[model samples]
Target chain A: MMENEVDGLDKRKAYILATVVYEYIATGEPVGSQALTQKYNLGVSSATVRNEMADLEAGGYLEQPHTSAGRVPSDAGYRTYVDALMSPEELGADERRRIRDEMRDARAQLDEIVEQSSRLLGRLAGNLAFVTKPQSDTQSFRYVQLIWIAERSGIAIIVTSLGVASQSLFELRNDLSPDDLTRLSNALNATFAGRLLRDCDDRSLTALTKSCGFGDDMAAAVRAAFIGARTQEQPGISASGAQHLLDQPEFRDVRKLRSILRILEEQRTLYDLVADAFDSPTASVKIGHELGSEELADLSLVTVPYRFGERAVGMLSILGPRRMPYARLLALASGTAETLSERLHDVEVK
Target chain B: MMENEVDGLDKRKAYILATVVYEYIATGEPVGSQALTQKYNLGVSSATVRNEMADLEAGGYLEQPHTSAGRVPSDAGYRTYVDALMSPEELGADERRRIRDEMRDARAQLDEIVEQSSRLLGRLAGNLAFVTKPQSDTQSFRYVQLIWIAERSGIAIIVTSLGVASQSLFELRNDLSPDDLTRLSNALNATFAGRLLRDCDDRSLTALTKSCGFGDDMAAAVRAAFIGARTQEQPGISASGAQHLLDQPEFRDVRKLRSILRILEEQRTLYDLVADAFDSPTASVKIGHELGSEELADLSLVTVPYRFGERAVGMLSILGPRRMPYARLLALASGTAETLSERLHDVEVK
Candidate 1:
């Protein structure tokens, strides 16, 4: 279809293709030339519209489910409509206000912000939505604390620059008094305060501890704590509103539903998919077969990267049937990502 | 239907009801008497089975989608089948091995354990599954540490008795060196150690700090750190396999799908629902209307509480259509919960 594409469609053919795609998205049914001419003021007679529809079919831009039925947009047809005819839909004032309020409330913590953003996106787009927290490997150390809980056990708490925290309990080879533990913590923080936790090396940690007059036992404890914090699993990925997929007529078959469920259950695949979308500076819409999975062939993914400062830290996305409101979803994804980035900056400042 | 209950059905009626429910669950189609006699060794003629089915419908145990169609199990019919006829389905050795292996690997952390459990449950049941991490309020303090990070900022690290660690950065009102912060941390830990963080009163903390020879300025910092640690929000709730809901025939309508997506997006409602399921000691099967939501009347929830030691701290559940295989799901939920509990205990012990 790509090789057989006709370049530079005439104004009438483009108008007819856009009208057919819009109508199919609104009503999960194919559009006929007669209905398009009657419903839309295309400034053409039914006969002229019929000839354009036939031309669209010949160009592989439209497909007919049956000989007697109307025409539906092919993958190429949707691609053309998204690429040229559609304008980004502006969100209503009330919706903008609601999104702003939700983002503000969620700005207090990283987890809440991610969860809230996913929920709000799902609600606005009426599709399954997901957001990934910033990967820990990309985050710099904001603070690290080791607190002795038992005679031989202590907890290591690590907070990243992104304000995300993680903790783990470790067994100590030797017991250290509160004063000694405090000194060890201060020395460790002074060494790696602004560096990414992933970049902290064992030799530097040991050398820093010894230079600070800590014994071998304290160095081992510090090393264990640093290793625990650095080796912690990746930041979480959360998804919501999967039931939205059930509304699509294409998902009426149980097999399709099962395949989608399998994909959702496999977080690694979803994370990779969202991460790949960050290659684009704006919202990236992967329509139909472009999503690179046979199971997702009937679906479209609209993704936009949310950032911390200029660094693209994470992503938010909406997954729906290929017959989706691409312009509106793209606008929503871009707008929400911008709001979320601003809110995160505000949180960091406070 | 409850009031119209006919107690102590004859052996033949009981068999017919079980067969109808099982067949409906398997094929997702209404079961006619002729099909029932053809499929099962009922040892009766089709005419005899037809009469029994009519009686079952009159007794409110079955329903007909259409006059000419076969009968399907009503809510009351499912309730009867679950209570009286179904036996727990035993998982094969391979499944048990897979669950055990997954849980063993996940036992190192609270978040990993919850995520793994939800994924395992969803995969085994082929339904939407969720697990909530233990709430912070319910956790007792195991350790506390205060480390000064800057002239006006320090990080407070708190460890719960369950080995879950949380950290938050607090602003210091006055400068405290490494030694003074150590004394303050020790005083705070001695006062609140082994006690619920929520029970630490402001007056007690101030007095404890003063008695330990700390000035009013130092006392304020200690109080601030303790309050910050105690006030952290509840642990997160995670869900997986929500796309599984689309596989159900009952969700063919977009309206039904939208309502469910809305519910899933509202985390508070989902949290409350999972929390309520902890009231039971075993796997709870809340069928249809028993779930207490009109929108969820077509669904069933199979929930089991996972414990840390003797405390029931979290829950795992599978959500599916009401026609779900109750016996198999109940067995899977209980088995997974038991495996999770044992794994958590092993982690704590090590």
Candidate 2:
């Protein structure tokens, strides 16, 4: 009974701290005892709330920005709220509908999909967004063909079972009839189709080359084309809406905005962050102060890993101010991740 | 004359302070008074150096991390050193040759060159490197050709007079004969050649479409293809050697690395930074504490813009700990920029 009572007190203290932070985040101003008493039905008087607020301030979660003004949530206060008080809100129907509509017939390609995802997330959340395509090894080969188009132009098309197709163009040095190229294409596809190119070692490529009975140069060219295709299968990072950072109060300093924009243009930074999220599928949120750089401590990041079929492929996320709508942002991030995985699976299944 | 003497004294003080910072950066430790006196020939004794260090500390430029430790340059000290005293040294011939070789053949295409430049800068300087591709409108029209490869595939090849090639693949649904596709390709290319796409308005596209005698569906498809191509050409951002940040003492906090990575991932952040360099081709440096963000005040960024022919195509830069070798880094950045531009012009002239 005594332990239960102590637990209740702790919970109550936590609730008060959370309330103060939440209020401050909404107003962009400090929260005071009278305002807290009037705005929230905490069943506490102004005097009681004031005493508690003082204790919270002393505990380092709340800060008096000035002696005359009320208390504002410190970085610590924001951290506590994000970790404990923020609830996961379900994605609204309209949001889900918009995402689905946007993704419909997005039959472009992996690169297009990643680029669109970034723009969509950025637009939806009014924050920076990033997406990378699924790794190529995970995309099993469905079919392959070679066709001679012009007298000197030849095209190689490889379609993954996942509905993704990659094509390359090479100039023919010698005259090869279209029918001969078709026959060679059939021979190659018969030998390699339905097998994972990623599973094919160098020996496998060599073996297939030999079985196809083509000139060594043509075989080498085909092998080069395959390798090139695989290199792009790892998916590239695409991001958008970085200008949103300028809209936030934290970035009022033009120099700060410039530094941030400089950072964003370096896509490797986004690639690393998104790649890190793949280790864990659950939506992750990083807050200011925790980010280690005092400049970034005022910002927040919410990210989730996306999947290709049963395996995780890459990550997608939103970057916004620390005072971002966490519940909505979390739901949006997770929902988008789920939808991306589902669409990718459908492609593979089809 | 009295005022000039006082100014000379201030300059001496500034020079002594800069020497201390330079030595600390070179040695990666707090600089001792004896070492400062012995190394720079400032004509001061150990006792005088100690007195100056004390004054510098009092002025908030230097600090002792611990009681028996020598003095280290604080963020303020580094800022003062960078702004007032640091004149980054010139690159040696060998260094220039090496940087030029690294940038060789990297400008074959805008996107490829940007990626290569970022990685090469990172590798050469041992710092995080960044580059952003020119805006699409800034690029002149390359020759455009569409080659039909198979039943469903075609390749769009665009070769700029500047030797940059942009390629994209298109998949066809309704069958079109190779001759007919070739005619269509020729027709479209003839209509759009030698003009900037950005200069074409909606009515122009419609007029071009009608004048080319393209069917409604084919015209729509071509428009979509053009728009899709433009989307990919939005802008390119690249960075390499992010792992280098881990080796910096300032980023000892893993959380700080995470935030920096997050900031770096946003290409818009960097695009905004480098775009400013095009305003002037001269080398520019943003030092620690000088950056607007209190969070980023501990780091420094050195950037130089590279030209394509007579026009600037992009900016290249390195990000590192504030205690960087500014002279070497500046030379590396500027040398790489000059090399990239010169080689690109060479390729064009060839």
Candidate 3:
């Protein structure tokens, strides 16, 4: 009846707990002993099943909403089910083909690829799906180019080793000619190439600019551009199918819906949530209150880091009500991340 | 209850129709004549209110869900109410100050400003909020720069007159030295500057590149860069607060939730929905079935075009259930768009 007793459940008890979780997820209702015995063909008598249900409720793995009603899995029960009895659901051929086709059609850019992944996951999982851009801090500098576009303004284009490009416009107190701009660009590439952008400090930039034999004004402009490049905003989170959460009966209460919606509005919260999943080498599941937000106490998130080359740069996730199909959603998250990573690998090569 | 007689409603009929719509919107229940008379101090008896309600129903502005129940506003009724009876809900001074502060702090880049506007509108209106990047097709080229990053790769930086910068990487069939890149960059800026990027056709690009007196390989690379710049993906749609839709009783049905979620997943659909509102000088309201998608038949959208300088290039919108407070949402959309437009103008000038 305590938290430490989760591992003490025998094989049959584990099977019963898993069945209860699965049935409640599918039917959005409590599971009774009679229904479990009748529908699952457990080879046990109704009385035996009832006794096990009582034990589960006592063990903190299940709860009965009413004295006479059936049992539902507690968060602890879901966690145990996910860790022990669950088998990753295999995707059907049509689903795989749909995912491949959508990804192939979206092979043009990083942004398009991430968006397509989010849409596909949301549709397949019937839940909110999100994909983050490969964090720039995790990427190494591939090239830097400064082009003087006006007398006092220039555009700086920074390309990461992952093939993502970003541009920013900088204004100068003094103008630089085309040759000066080219020299500055070359100096920047020489100093920062193959290094993580976040590791670029102002001191190194100033030293490099000074070493390039530039006057103070030109060096200052170069320093501003380099600093601007390093501190650019992180690649944002792209989310889709949020409306799918409304389909859950738990969200029927307006207050609950509002609280959850407010959490989703904070981009940083979502980014951190998925970013934490990168520490795990495979699919990671945070059930209900484990998500660290009281507002999300009724929800669960299943996430996997989608990689590019050897590094985990971004993550894909499926968020839903706690009574979600863990096996199926985890499988989907794993499969989609693998496919997306392969596609991104191809993009990097091209 | 025909559509043509909407304008013929007398003062008393307008008052009663407006009262019914307002009461239904606030309470999410049918408005009975007795309840309207008791709650609204309309200087009319229950019998007179009942007679007016019957006439409104006959004229198609009101509907009775059942034979004996009270009345609700039909689509036509809501439209009439928006056009004539409702006074725009002005934002209080504190709300105005909050929006202004948020915009002022978000003035660094077009993307950030648009995102801040979306978050602000979503929070204030308590609905799904979206803002689009200024469409490239609507923007003229301010500058174009081609910079060689590696032996076979280069980045093309395109700066629109609105001060938004975009970058794309292109593969080179032949290597270009610094002089060649500079010449190509100058030629591109000379040929396409001040012209709408959408007007940069392949034929024009080929002609311009050939006229630049470069070798065919070099000309082809230049042409590729120009065409790539022209076809760069449009600034994307940023959406937030989609979870708010679940708070509406109308979206309590799983089917409705799924349909709306599917629409929100399609970025092009959202872009087109708000893009249509650009023709209006101020806020535009699309109620219920007028949104052009059967999936969105139960939703309402309030949108206003956020401009860059004098040209309307992007839109801001609030998406919610049809029972939303149209006046307040419209006013919020208008105020936010105006503030965003001014902030973007300041960025462009700098």
Q: What is the C-alpha RMSD of each candidate to the true structure, in Å?
A: 4.7, 11.2, 3.8
| Top lDDT hit | 3
Comparing 2 with 3 on TM-score, the higher-scoring candidate is 3
CA lDDT scores, all candidates in order: 0.77, 0.68, 0.79
Docking class of predicted structure 2: incorrect
Error of 2 at A230 (Å): 4.6
Which CAPRI tier for candidate 1? Answer: acceptable
Lowest lDDT sum, 10 consecutive residues, model 3 chain A, at: A1-10
Model 3 bad stretches (over 4 Å)? A1-6, A41-43, A88-98, A215-234, A247-256, B1-6, B38-44, B88-95, B215-235
**Recovered fraction of real interface contacts per model:** 0.67, 0.00, 0.59
Per-residue lDDT over A250-309 for candidate 3, one digit per residue giving the tens place of the 0 to 100 score: 776667766755666787788777767878877889998899988888789999888877
Among these predictions, the greatest DockQ belongs to 3
For model 1, the superposed segments whose C-alpha errors exceed 4 Å read A1-7, A10-29, A32-71, A88-95, A150-152, A172-180, A201-203, A206-234, B1-77, B88-95, B172-178, B197-235, B246-259, B346-350
The residue-by-residue lDDT of candidate 2 on A1-350, one tens digit each, is 11222222365667777778778767767788899889999897988888888887888878897897898877777776776665658888988988977976465455556676777787778787777677676667655556455566565656665545555556666677766666776666667666766864556766776666656656765776576557663366677776566556665544454445445555656565556566785778777765545656667788888887677777887877777887788787777877787776544523
Q: Name model 2 segments beyond 4 Å from true.
A: A1-109, A112-132, A135-227, A230-338, A344-350, B1-14, B27-35, B45-88, B92-117, B143-181, B194-203, B215-224, B231-234, B253-258, B338-350
**Candidate 1 residue-wise lDDT, A74-155, digit = tens:** 8899999888777668777887788898787763667777888888888778888888877667677767676655567666
